[model samples]
Target: MNATDRTLAGLLSAALSDDPSRPLVTYYDDATGERVELSVTTFDNWVAKTANLLQDELSAEPGDRLALLLPAHWQTAVWVLACASVGVVTDLTGDPSAADLVVSGPDTLDAARSCPGERVALSLRPLGGRFPQPPEGFTDYAVEVPGQGDRFVPYAPVDPDAPALALPDGSELTGAQAVERARQDAAARGLEPGSRLLSALPYDGWEGLSAGLLAPLAAGGSVVLAPRLERLDAASLEQRVENERVTHTAA
Candidate 1:
């Protein structure tokens, strides 16, 4: 990211323009036996579709609160960026009762049911498929997102100073603030343009969020996010680092 880049969305735009074919997010879930890699163009497409679903279908606004009851997987990264694109405040704690919208995974269905506003559920299956049976009082994200335009045009201008992320600690930061913080953290972590970081952190707080997604983007780097890193043996992880050309590791 450059001096002019202020928000997470701007970082993505820069990445897409810089190298659309570069790998942006590579994910692995040992428990589910899932592995997926998304190039800059593909990641942007998913973000566009997800943003459309948030804006058009869920009526999400720039200042809306979105609780994500998801893990540190590829789809979660997509949702975070989508929220950033729409200027929505992403709450990782996923407290449904306090959010304007909640997107839940299979394990958190019951918790998400408590959310009073718009609720969407994902199967978190291969290719980010929809639930086999729709949850009550909730829309299926996979079913609705495909029809959204590949390109996203926000209906309103999102102020960079508006709050973009809310952590469970009751702390919040604007888009610009988050970007600045991520840049600092990225530098501290020795990430630079085109650097590939292999991260094994949950997406539950600022540290994890920064390492797994925001910081790398702010640094114009990519990530190989291991959601179940502890399950992978040392040899396996070493092989992964070699295969993915990981330049750094965050445990």
Candidate 2:
């Protein structure tokens, strides 16, 4: 009965078909004081468009590792889902050597450039409308989202056992393993489609990549991302829990 029982592409196709009007994500920007909510239909379309860009613009393929250096913003969400749809390896890291393509904010560009790979750095500034000077050898993310249609050009089916992400501990897990872990957790907790989860952490690495991005999608739930915390304070976390109405919290 799980909605995400099919492949990531199938899960998205289901979401687009059945509950296109449902609110898939809600973005709350503390800096700009803006709130943007997207429905399932729009969310699916954007993911498809981003998938095309990753394959066409960035030269990403099913087995290639497309790194994501994004924060807990909307664009991060889009690329995470897009990578899943096409069976590309999405290795989330701040370290540029770990990725084939990197998407990030301005501050990390220096660190990103040092490692040297096929990088695709992006700006978070334009998302807020106060466009900062972009890093050299990067692309404009603002100009990238528009001008693409909603159709997801299907690719060859992927092996469920294929590696989808690389871990920091030099460990690699297959896509089936990832889905099984999520399924086990969800069944233990009685979770299903429409269940809400609060990502209580950053999405830049192994723990974040597994629990924050993949698990929620595998469980057919919306993942609510928390702001990057330089320091994790008890009181601040409690407030976030109350604000986000987090059904399940993972580190």
Candidate 3:
């Protein structure tokens, strides 16, 4: 990461500049036998569209709390960066009633209805498919995001010192702090530029966020996320490691 990169957006910009075509997130769902890989450029485009959806459609602003109820998936990673870009503070495992907005996946729609603000649902399907039937009181993220502009411009600049993440333990981290911690974790894990880290961690806390997303972004490396990892047999896991050319492991 660059000395001046204090926010997730800055870190992503640096990565895009370094290599736009390199794979940044390689996601695998062993239970479904599904795999999806997103290059830096593609990932940025998804982030841009989602950011636009948050800023323009949802009218989400800086410091607004968004309850993010999703699993360790590629689209979840997109939402993380999208919230950062628009200065929306993401709450992982937060109560829906306390949030200004709520994003839930197929399994959490009922719980997410407590939020009075704009609600969005993700199908979490391959290629970002929409729900077969749109849930009541919630907009489909995959349906809404595609029509948004490819570029995103926040209404106000994000402050590096402003709180960006609200943890399950009720702790918060500013944008700068999160970036710094990601870099620190990357170094501690021996992650370097061009390294490939395979992760089988849930996205409910900092450990998973760092290993599955931020650490790779901080180190200019890539991540191979294996969600529902327990379902993968030992032989399948080994084959995945070999196929993805994984240099590091975080389980």
Candidate 4:
């Protein structure tokens, strides 16, 4: 990452510039036997679309708290970058009742209803499929995101010192701080450019965020996310590591 770029958005932009066609995130779901790989260009498109959805359609603004009630899935990673791009504060594993917007997975729909503002739901199906039947009071993310403009321009500039993430312990990390921490973690974990780090950590704390998403981005590497990794046998896990060309692991 460029030394002058102090935000996750900047890191993503740098990665896209460096190698747009390289794999950025590879997701595997052992339960469903599904694998999905997103190149830097494709992931950026998703982030741009989702950011536009938050800014134009949902009227989300800088510092607006968005409760992200999702797990360690590829879509969840997209939401994180989208929020960063829009300057919205992502509340990981947060309470829905206090948020201005809420994004939920299939298992968290009931909990997400407490939020009084906009609600979006992801089916967590392969290929970003929409829910078979739309959930009441929740916008289907798969339906809304596709039609959004491919390019995203924030209404205002994001402050590097402004809060970007709110952790479950009620702590906050500003954009610059998060980037710095990510870089530190990346170095500590021996991550290098083009390193393929496979992670099975849940997106609930700093460890997971650093290992699964931020560090890889900061280091200009790629991540292989294995959600529901416990379901995979030792042989299957080994095969996945070989197939993904994973150089490091954090489970």
Candidate 5:
């Protein structure tokens, strides 16, 4: 891969071509007893569909800003990459009024509805479920995303220099910057090809973004994201490390 091919989508495409069958994300939520695994091929497929959903159903243009109100789960990671795929700026916050679109999780339904523009809600349930009865005005993501086409070609090409991530403290990184930083962090974290990293970091800021999402992808490794980490007892956590063959960790 070229050093300058630093766009998030470009990096993901490279991963897909390099080793599509490799596992990419393994999610565990001991609190909810959720275990979800995704291979590179599977992840790419979901990203394509979600990108298509964003572009076709939500009209998420390249410059669109999306405030993501979700946890560190498998599908949330999908949304992050999906936003990057189509050049949507992802804000890791619950403040929807500041964004063009707000992706609210199960806990933020009421606050998310205050957004003036479009709204999408994810149940964050296992297998990505829709609300039992559906929300009043928001589109249920799990219900609608799967029906979208499996391919996505953005209406306009994404600029590598365009902003892609928004942190809680108002810091932001462009697509190229985020990718480059991830590469550097991956090296620093001793990640290598096929390394399995067990991480108990929340997807809140740079550290979380690096460990939980980007570093693994950047280094041709995979992440075992353990959300609600405190819920896992010492023995359970240790057992997970051995089970996943974890080579690196960030807790």
Candidate 6:
């Protein structure tokens, strides 16, 4: 795809098309205390299936607010991409009541349910964890939504000028601006298309989404997400950068 046509979703689709078996994100889970590797093709499938569910089952519109309250991990990766694919506005902040739908962990699901302002809510069970009891009056996120296809029925292309995401403070950002920022950041770091990125941050914020993942994907590069590394100091960050040969490393 040309630079003009590149997007986070588009680049991921292209990468999987060329090398479905390529590794996307690899990390260890503290809950299971085990190492896990997620491939591009598998990750794409999760994104596709979840995107279809978001559009068909949840009836999410292109700009509808969707919140996530889980820990930063592969599931976060899937939901983030699903939101991008279907044009659902992802709200990463833990406040579930402020959203049309929410994906949250077992611990926070009860507190999330106490506020009844949400249109629909889904409790997100992290991988390797027991399906925790959903708070009263809440729904399990795993139930297949009716009419959700096995594959995604690509959502209509969103208006580039329309707001694609909402910040914790309720501020919004346009799709065009998000794309432009990703491109610009990659260019500034001399990490254009084909560069590789290794990020030690969570996708729960703009820095992780734009600079760490989307920017690299938009530029025909790849990102390896290492969530807990955020607690690392500057020395650790530099060590990772050198070992990974990461062209662009951001906090």
Minimal lDDT window, size 10, model 5: 1-10
CA deviation > 4 Å runs, candidate 4: 1-4
Candidate number with the higher lDDT (1 or 2): 1
Indicate whether candidate 1 or candidate 4 has the larger TM-score.
Answer: 4
lDDT string, candidate 1, 12-101, tens digits? 999999999999999987888788999999999999999999999889999999999998888899999899898899998758998999
What C-alpha lDDT does candidate 2 achieve relative to the native structure? Answer: 0.64
Per-residue lDDT value at 213 in model 4? 91
Per-residue error for 206 in candidate 1, Å, reads: 0.7
Shift of residue 65 alpha carbon in model 4, Å: 0.2
Instruction: Give TM per candidate.
Output: 0.96, 0.79, 0.98, 0.98, 0.96, 0.76
For residue 110, model 6's alpha carbon misses the true position, in angstroms, by 3.4
For residues 1-251, could you state the per-residue lDDT of candidate 4 as single tens digits? 44339988999999998999999999988888888999999999999999999999999999999999999999999999999999999999999999999999999999999999999999999999999999999999999999999998999988889999999998999999999999999999999999999999999988998898999999999999986888988998899889889999999
Clashing pairs in 4: none
Best by lDDT: 4
Model 4 local distance difference test score: 0.94
Rank the candidate models, highest lDDT first: 4, 3, 1, 5, 6, 2
lDDT of 4 at 58: 99
Q: Which digits, one per residue and each the tens of the lDDT, describe model 2 over residues 1-251?
A: 34234455555566677667866665555455555566778778789888877777767778877656677676677877787777787666635765667766666677667545555556665343423565567766666656555676735565667776666555766666666765666666566787766654666565665455556655676666554432446886677667766677665
lDDT of 3 by residue, 1-251 (tens): 44337888878888999999999999988877889999999999999999999999999999999999999999999999999999999999789999999999999999999998999999988878899999999999988998999888888889888999999988999999999999999999999999999999999999999999999999999999996778977998888889999999999
Query: How much does candidate 4 score in TM-score?
Result: 0.98
Once model 6 is optimally superposed onto the true structure by TM-score, how far is the C-alpha of residue 158 displaced, in angstroms?
2.8
Clashes of 2: 0
